[model samples]
Structure formats: C-alpha cells, structure tokens
Target: MEHRVVLVTGGSSGIGKSIGIYLKSKGFKVYGTTRRLDSHPNFTDFELLELDVRNPESIGFAIARLMEREGRLDVLINNAGIGITGPIEETPHSEILKAFDTNFNGPIHMSKAVLPHMRRQEKGLIINITSIAGYMGLPYRGFYSASKGALELVTEALRMEVKGFGVNITNLAPGDFATNIASGRYHAPILSDSPYKEPYGNTLKMMNEHVDSGKDPMLVAQMVFKIINTKNPKVHYKVGEFMQKFSLFLKKILPDKVYEKLLMNHYKL
Candidate 1:
C-alpha cells in the first residue's frame, strides 16, 4: 500500500508538530509547514515547508512543492491557528483581523487549495483544529472564540458540499491541551486605570493556568489518527477534559442566562 501523504499547516511546533510526527511514525508521508524554516534549528521530525496560511501564494507554492514530491496528497490537517485575548473594548481592530486571518481564514484557504487535488484523487480527509471555546463566547477571548466559531460553521457547509467527491471534512474542538498556543496568542495588555483591568487581569491569569495544567497534545494527535481512519466520519468532534466537553452539552440544555452566569462564575468575573 502506498503511504498516504499528509500536509499539516503550522507544523513547526506544539500540536501541529505532534500530529506530523505521530502520523509519520504510523508510516504516512508527512509534510509540515512553518512560516520560517530557520525558526526551529533542531526540528527534524519530518519535512518542514515554508508557508504562511495568511498568504494564498505561499499556500499554493508550498502545496505545489509537496505535490511535486509526493504526487498525491491524501490528508490536510488545518491545524495552523493563533490565540488572541483582550477585552473587545481595548483589542485593536487590526489585531482582531489578524486573528481571523490566521485562525479562521487560513483554514478556509487551505481547504480550498486542497479540495481540487482531493477531488481528482476522489479520496481525502480535512480535519480542522478548532477550539471548544469556539462554542461559546469567553469574556476576554471573545474575538478568538468568534474566529474559531466561524470555522466550525464553515466546516459544516464545506463538508456537505464536497462529500460527493469522496472528500471528508470535520471540526475537532479541543478544550485545552498543553501546548505553546498561549505564548503565540495576542493578549491585550491590561490597562492599570481601565474599568476592565481588574476582571481582565484575573481572567488572564486563570487562562494561563488552564493552559499550563492542560492535557497533552499527543491526545489530540491520537484523535486525529482516529479521524483519518474512520469511514463516513461525523461532522463535529470534541476532544478534551470531560467537564470541558460537558460544558457544551450544558449550554444546549441550560437557559441562556443560566449558561451565561455559569461562564461568569467559571472565570470568576
């Protein structure tokens, strides 16, 4: 059997890197993309391509390179994303747009680039790495949530549109797996004299703690492997601590205000 080729965006480190390495271990040909190849001097887990998801030309060139080498691409993990947190009042519009570009728009463009290739092959899988937070609006991370939430909806639409071509699309919403996402996220500096300073500060600290104590990214990678092998996979999947996954269930059943209050209590706002 020929090795199934995989392309993972943002594969330089953390979750993307884990997915790439694990898939390679399973005998798949893995190509991971990083904006700068020189950034990680010791990264030799798999082939790293230079591509920024925000730039269409970059995305195209990288895929072209992969196609030239591998001849066929079988899986695309839209795992490249950035985290952003700030009070909506203080977060710069430019920064908000940047988050959308990488987190939301990046996946859409990557999928568009791959769909043509997949359609020709008549078999492919696209798993989007969304966040559980995308299911609800978190206080300081509203923009981040919105961007990811948008991806979830788009995945639903894109899945139906491409199923006839033997292409599968799904969203995997991970609650919080220990990774470097916190470091790369855009955090609005808490203003000392601002009205939201106190609450925002506390929430920010709590958010970091959650990431620090979060589960391993390998778990996410394992789930990715499972999704790849499953035939007729579902449209939405969640992987995380039980309570985090349960929170979504609660939101569906609880009254709107009740859920909102629960969130406020969770964040200690």
Candidate 2:
C-alpha cells in the first residue's frame, strides 16, 4: 500500500479527512476533495481538491487533476455524502432529490468516472462509505436510508461486472459517528401544528444526540487501511458498536411487523 495514490471525496473533514490523514501517515499518497477548497484553510493533512459530487464537470476535473498528478489512482473512497432527516411526507421533494444526488448518484458517477482508468491498469479498489441505517428503513430518515442502500446494492452488481477487469468495489457501512454530519443534515422544520410534530421532533433530538455520543471516525479509517492491504476484500464491511452492527443481523431475522414495532419502540413512537 506504500505510495499508492488514494482519493477520498468529502475528505476535508470528518471520516474522509481522518482516512486521508491515517493513510498519509502510513506512506500512501492521499488526496481529498471538498466542494470548496478555500473554506478549510487549516486542512493540511493531505492535499484537498475541489469537487462537488453532484456536478459532472467538477467530478471530471478533480479526477483528471488527480490522475495527472499521481499518474494513477490506486483507490477511490466514495465517502462524500449528506444526512437528511424528516418525515418523508413533510420533507421537501427538493431535499430528497439533493440527498439522492449526493449519496446515491454521486457515488455511481464517481465509480463510472474511475472505471476506465482502473480498467486500463487492471487494478483498483473502490470503497463506498455507506451507512448502517441503509440496511433498513429508519423512521424520519427514509430517504437517507434509500440513498445509501441503493449504493450498497449497486456495489454488489458493480463488483461482479468489473471483477474480470481486476477492479474491486465494496461497501463500508458505518454506524453513527461523532462527525459534523448533524450540522449539515437537512432537517425538516418541526411545525407546531403538524400532526407528526412530537414524534418527528423527538426523533430529530434523538438522532443528533446519537451523533454527539457516537464513536470516533478513526475506526473507519483503520478499516479502510485494512481493506486496502487485503488480497481479496469483501463486498460489504460494517464498522460500529456491537449493537449498531447487530441491528443489521436482527433485521435479517426479524419478521416485518416485529422489526417495525422494535423500531417504533426504540424511537418511542
């Protein structure tokens, strides 16, 4: 893994930044992308490139610059994403679209953009940073779940499609982490007169609290390093507390209504 060039989208902060720093410390050439390069004047852990996953031009330019600089892109970590929470009915359609564009389409486009280069070299790995919530439909976070879940499934199919080309793609679904995701999350306002006010409001409060008390982002970085060093990586990887990861196991075994009831009870709905 030494001197291998890695690109992490949304690397200016949080999990992406942590991964970049950790990899750089291990002697890998790492580059991170933020939509705005000037916003983070102090982010010197690794080179940060300007890119907005939702824009095709920005994606191409960033990928081109990295390819030119390093002459190769060894790994692509699709870690850039946004968090959205609100009653699906109450959340603006625009917000839903934005969430999907960033969380789902952006990664697909990124994978597509990098495939040619990877195929040409016949060696590359793409790690999609998804969410545990993506495994199930969570209350007030349906769209967010859908977007990540979409990426998860896409990774499954893409891995097969590109396996012969010597390219590997995988999903790393993390549980809540103490990142700035809360501040950037688009929260549907709690309308006082709305029918779902109390539940949505309570859920929103719980969501933010979970993030505030979540584990460090460095754990994810460690996993990223491990996956890179492995000769054969899996299609999906989860990093989080036991219960958070266990919940996915439960979802697989629990009946439909039982799981729904459990979620409702957990959120106190």
Model 1 per-residue lDDT tens digits across residues 1-269:
99999999999998999999999999999999999988878988999999999999999999998998988899999999999999999999999999999999999999988899999999999999999999999999999999999999999999999999999999999998899989998899999889999999999999999999999998999999999999988999999999999999999999999999999999988
TM-score of each: 0.99, 0.98
Location of the lowest summed lDDT over 10 successive residues in candidate 1: 35-44
The model with the greatest TM-score is: 1
Show the colliding residue pairs in model 1: none
lDDT of 1: 0.94
TM-score, cand. 1: 0.99
Instruction: Residues 23-85, candidate 2: write the lDDT tens digits.
Output: 999999999999998899887799999999999888999899888878889999999999999
Compute the lDDT of residue 49 as modeled in candidate 2.
94
Q: How close to the true structure is residue 148 of candidate 2, measured as C-alpha lDDT? A: 95
* lDDT by candidate, in order shown: 0.94, 0.94
